[model samples]
Target: MAYQVLARKYRPQRFSDVAGQEHVTRTLLNALAQGRIAHGYIFSGHRGIGKTTIARILAMALNCRTAIGTEQRPTPEPCGVCESCTEIRAGNAVDVIEIDAATNRGIDEIRELRDAARYSPARDRYKIYILDEAHQITDAAFNALLKTLEEPPDHVIFMMATTQPEDFPQTIRSRCQHFSFHAVRFEEILTQLRTIAVEEDVIAEDAALALLAEAGDGSMRDALSIMDQAIASAPLDNGKARLDAEQIRELMGSVPNTVFERLMEAISENQSAPVIEEINRLINAGNSPSQLARQFVRYLRNALMARIAGENSELLQISPDERARAARSAMLFSEEDLTRFLQVMLRTFDELNYRQEQRFHLELGLLKLVHLQRLLPVEELLSQLPAPTAGKGSLGGGPLPGTLPRLQAAPAPARPAAPAQSPARPAAPARTEAPIAEPTRPAFSPFEADRDRKITSEATTPAAASAAPPAPQALTPIETAARAAETRATEATRTTETRATEKMQPAAVVGVAEPIAEGALALAAEADTAPEAAAGGSLDLDRIREAICAALEREGHNTATALLDAGDWKQSNGAIEVTLAIKKTMLALTMNAEADKICRNTLKQLGVGEKLVFLPGEASSAAAAARPRAAASGSVQAAAMENPLVRQAQELFRAEVRTVLDLRDRK
Candidate 1:
């Protein structure tokens, strides 16, 4: 006899020997014990999952003659040594007929079997007909067997098996007892392999058997076949068969888990060089790029499952050590990153076969994975940005010197002292001193005022007028009186000259004096109310702007503060103006409203008036109408021509400036 492979040599001979599919086995055993066996039976499942084997066991149980304690009936558990059982196991039972439906699939063949079904058993208690791949039978053949299948003789049993049960017509399926099978579990497959290894005296490691079982992909037959191949091809050491994971990997053209770990680490670290080198090494070692991609996809899937389902997920078929390693690798990536990596590899696997340069494509895909952005939650990213300063308004303060030039305060006019009265003029109404008003405007220091006066006199006086300013050093009483009289006469002359100049420059003088007067009055009122204001502790325009910004930030109105930070602030006639570009109209409105309220409250607290105003970027319709058309057009053209690129294009094309359009003006 030819040497039998492990699959055939260890074929399940009894119902109890079958692993998994307990549903089918238990139902069949119960039916036999209660003598409730059906006339027709159908077994359906994936290949190598014990469909045909179960059918054979059922047949032997039906025909066995060896009784259990002289009961004159067949038993659920067949006596293997009995002639009927031995013959069925050997596939030579006279009463049992196993037909390959793939070859005998026509109506004529089914008709012949249907005719044979009418007769009684030749020897055994019952005649059994088992058809494999029963779905392959033609429609006409299924129709011919329908009547016989529906009501088979009591002494005959019809057993049909197919991997695809749905292909059979409903009319035929309804008449048979259907038993569905499922793929065997990993543990069952692994246990079976270990038992075979020990029984065969093959020196195989448990890890090697586990790998073989995983490679089987839920098929016991495939597992046994792979084990047989490994045992034969395994190199002998000290006259003993030796098999390990490395040898299995070499035979299967697979990379070890360690290789996958190394690749994952390199990708997480964004090291493209090591990734490229690893790929080259694998390719040089005879590993197919497409195969490696598929294995990597599997590895990532395992790691992802471990992350989501913990280390004890049934989906993860790896060992505890491998699970721990996978869990550690999973910690290096977020779920989004792992998912993206899987997607890229799976897509590359699909395209790998079509590409002419497989290695190039693989390298490109892996490189993309290496440079993929780290996945961070939106909340976390937002937390890293600088937070806005609280409770501050951008307006309310005066202009910042850093942003704009400083304004110089004009000097106040000095008052001359009254002359001492002699008894002769009868005390021309004792000179009354005007009450000093609190200074609203910032006052110029005496040093600054004196410096300005000197500068003014130097710039305005003629050489003759300047030279006559020397006074007599020592004098008698008459001389002192004469000197004072002469000095008064000269001052009167200078005053006459200044008044004439002031009249000539009335516009400049008036414009400068009005604001100074208003500021002075305000400062005096503030000083009278609070002594601190007199001491220069009162808040100024700049301080008000800073305080408003601080207030806005405290209220979580960061948007308003940011907009105001780049704004222009001005104070004219006691009114404060805040000018900002209106990029978003609604946002501008909201910010203005909030800022107005905050500015009012802050100014009230600082003893300032609540006169805040928002300046619109575009002129109103009435204002535009009031402007001269020619001047507006000229301004627009000037702005357009100011851009270098626009000017170059105009010169190149010898074009005149047409209408200038503002994109922001459009709806």
Candidate 2:
């Protein structure tokens, strides 16, 4: 006999013989025994999953004539030895007609089949028609058979099998009892492969058989065919056919499990050199880069499933040894790291088809995995950082903690007074005098000693300011020193102004040009000494309110300042009770905490005793008091422009007032 492929030689003859399709088989068997056979039936599922096989079994049960007495009736289990059963299994039965819809899919073929359905069985009890790949039938053909299919003769049974049931029209599908077949499970395919290996007397390792089953991808027929090929290629050692993992790997052009294990180990250890070496070895061995990526993805998927579902999960399709290995490997990587590695490999697989340098992409992808597995999660790294400390000059203030304090300009050295010139002869010009030698000062000093001396002289001696200094006939070092001092003073003033503008707030800028006098510094020092005395002495309600508003404006709290400035203040029970308009209530509530701190600090600095209190009042009264009583719109604009707060805001924001509105007019 010619060599028959394992797929056809082991074709299922009875319902029980079909693997991984018990649902369809059980349903058909019950229908046969209960005498509930439908005139038309459709079996739909993926290829090689027993859709056509189950259809043939149903046909055998319908037409079998070997059943006698109690078995005479329609039997679920057909005896394959009977003449009718044997002929049907052999595809040579006269009564059971098998048609390939792909070849006979036109309207004419369907018409012929429809006409033939009217005839009784010639050799069997019932005429059975099996249409394979029925979805390939033309629309016209389906339309032609619609009526006949719905009302077939009593002795005829129509059985159709298709891999794609969606291609069949609803009218055709609704006329038949549809049964959907599922893909065979990994375990089921593996078990069947093992059985076939034993029956063929081929020596194969369990791991090799498992790989064959996985390569089949949930198809029993494909697994059996692969096994048959493996057996053919196996070399006989002492009359025992030898099949091992190495032979399987060579036949499939697949990387061995050891290579994947080494690669994963290198990644876990963050060793890029080993990973690259393994990839090069696989490439030199003729394994395609794209195929390597796909296989690695499969390995990662198995590892992930093993981690999440343990070794017992039905989703994992590896042998016990491989499963245990994956579980141990999974512990070396975090879930996040595993997920990232899988994503990279999958993306690399997709890019391989479009990329010209596929090997380079694969190398870079594996390198990325090696580096990524060594990274700690963000949460873990954050937990390792030192906690922030709390205090002034710590990260809890205006400036960031650890920043250097602002530098102060040193005072200029004192210079001796110039000697009095003789009045008898014409006095030498100021420029002819020798220049004074003064100690060097920092470049940031705002003023020179010469300017200060001149100012003091003018202040003390009114007559001396009116008399101009005499000009010298020849240039002298003394006069040159004075000129240089003036230039240096000007440059220093410019530098100080620039620094202040960059660092200080708008309110602070207002006083940038005003130098703090010795007397004022003395008063500030005193105030710092006795805050309570200062607060009690300056506790006037109006003064306290103004100080609070000024402090708020300095901090860029314009809205809060406006709200506080518009409030009506009254002193009662050692507290300043301020009533705000209804519209400002929400603003006050939002800024309560910040405002309280600012108010307390300002009162302490101003030596004010009164505590601040905020209250919401009727809009009518508050609005009447807050509104500017301007006689005309021009006056309102003038007042708004003249307001110090508005001027500061304009300077701070570099904005201009577009329009001004009168609150009274609004009412």
Candidate 3:
């Protein structure tokens, strides 16, 4: 006989000889023993797994002469020594016919087969027809043979094998029994390869055989085919062929996963130079950039799987050595980090498919892995901030609500730029980095030190203020720091109000260059609103009320403005009192500090003092003491610009208030 490939030589001869298909085999054996043979059968599954082989075995069993009578044959298996079984096994039986559906897939061919299946068996007890690649049959052909397949002759049997059971029409498949096959597993393939090696007298190392089994990827026929090729290329030792893992890998054009694991180690360490050097060396050794990228994607996928499901989990489908190596690499990264690395490599593999500069893109992808390892998640950054203190504000007021603490910007020394190195490998890379200039520390900040001193000087008594800064009691460092921060925050707020006041006024009037509470608050309401009421200027009580009402409307306090406008507004000692026309309960709800926030903000905008008081009464003139009043003229904007300070600004800077935006919503 001519030299036969191992795939055909060691093909399964009986149901028990097949590996990893006990489900299909056990059912077939029971059916045969009971003589409950089906007229038609379909086997479907992955390529190179015994779909077609099992179909042939079934044909032999059905036609075996000695096994026809259940009394003669002790087992359901075919007696290979019988004339009918021998002829069927050799593929020349008169009644057992095997058809390749890929070639004869037309309606004409199916019609011919249907006509032939009607006839009685020529030699064996049953006429069996086997169809391989049955999925290739056209819909018309399947329709043509549907009736014949559904109701074949008593002596006729049909068997079909396919990889895609879904491709067959439901009509054709419904008339047949489908035996779905599973891929042969790793251990089964490994055991088969070992048995084959020993039978062939090939001296294969254990690692070499393990590599062949993994490369098979769960297909017994594929593994045997590869082994046949490996043996052909194996070097001779005395008389037997000697196989090594490296020799098999070279023959298969595969880079051992060890190379990829080394690359992963370089990436986890963030060693750019090593990653680049390794790629250069691999390419120099004749590894294609695309192939290397493809291999790396597989390696990264395994590592990510190992990170998520432990190394021993079935999710990592690899040899024991590879699993251990994957676990080691997985330890170097978080699950998220491994996920990102895998994503980058998968994209790189796809790019290498059509990219002109494969090597360059591959190297850039590896460097990206090194860079991605340096990223810090937002949650981690937020975690580094100080936690909020419970109870009162740092300055002992209402609680401060937010995720972050108040940050203090101290004068930090300019840090000399450290030498360039990978974050994962603190000592490597050694590339030159630009020096970071030290931050300049001024003697005093325009807002901080000066403002603190100004606050200290505003005290009624220096000893009273210096002895105890807190109103209630002395505080710890946390509390004291909180108080100082609160003071700075308050200073910033007052400074903002002063700037707004100055904008409404011009340079001629004394615009609030200081905080309103300092000295600006001492002025009467008319002096603050109507520029004519400044220290020596003249402004009427009615004009002050109009200005305050207009300001309230601008601040979105329409209800307050309408109600307060109905009442008489009087200004005395910088305090504006509004005696509203409502019940006492309604009075408190409408005028509490929180509810009256709009009124306070409006007063501030008109440059009036922030103090406001609400009383319940009617708006008739008899409800309050008399105060001089004047009917105001001109629009509110015109009056604002009429301020001496505002007119001065317009004249000096040639500016005008083009538009105004309410920013309190965001605040």
Structural similarity to truth (TM-score) of each candidate = 0.57, 0.59, 0.63
Candidate 2 per-residue C-alpha lDDT over 1-667 given as tens digits, one digit per residue, 9 for 90 to 100: 8998888887888788888888888888888777888999999987888887887888888777766335543456887778888888888999999999999999999999999999989977889899999999999999999999988888988889998999999999899999988889888888888887787778888889888988888888888888788888889988878889889888888876767877888887668998998889889978999989988999898888888888778878777888887887777666777888899989988999899999999999999897675444566435534454321221222222212211111112223223322323332222211244345543322123223312222445758755857533332233344344444434434444454555543221111121121101000111132444324443466666567766775565655655566667676544456665432214223244455556656766775544445554432444434543232334554676776866676676654442333334332
C-alpha lDDT of all candidate models, in order: 0.67, 0.67, 0.67
- Clashes per candidate (backbone, < 3 Å): 27, 10, 9
Tens digits of lDDT, candidate 3, 329-381? 88877888888888998888898888899999999999999877655545643
Give lDDT: candidate 1, residue 180: 91
lDDT string, candidate 1, 121-210, tens digits: 989999999999999999999999988888888988989999899999999999988999988888899889889888887889878988
The deviation in Å at residue 571 for candidate 1 is 21
For model 1, the stretches where C-alpha displacement exceeds 4 angstroms are 68-75, 371-667
TM-score of 1: 0.57
Candidate 3: clashing pairs of residues = 414-438, 505-645, 505-646, 506-645, 506-646, 507-645, 509-645, 532-537, 532-538
- Supply the global lDDT for candidate 3: 0.67
- Cα error, residue 66 of model 3, in Å, equals 1.6
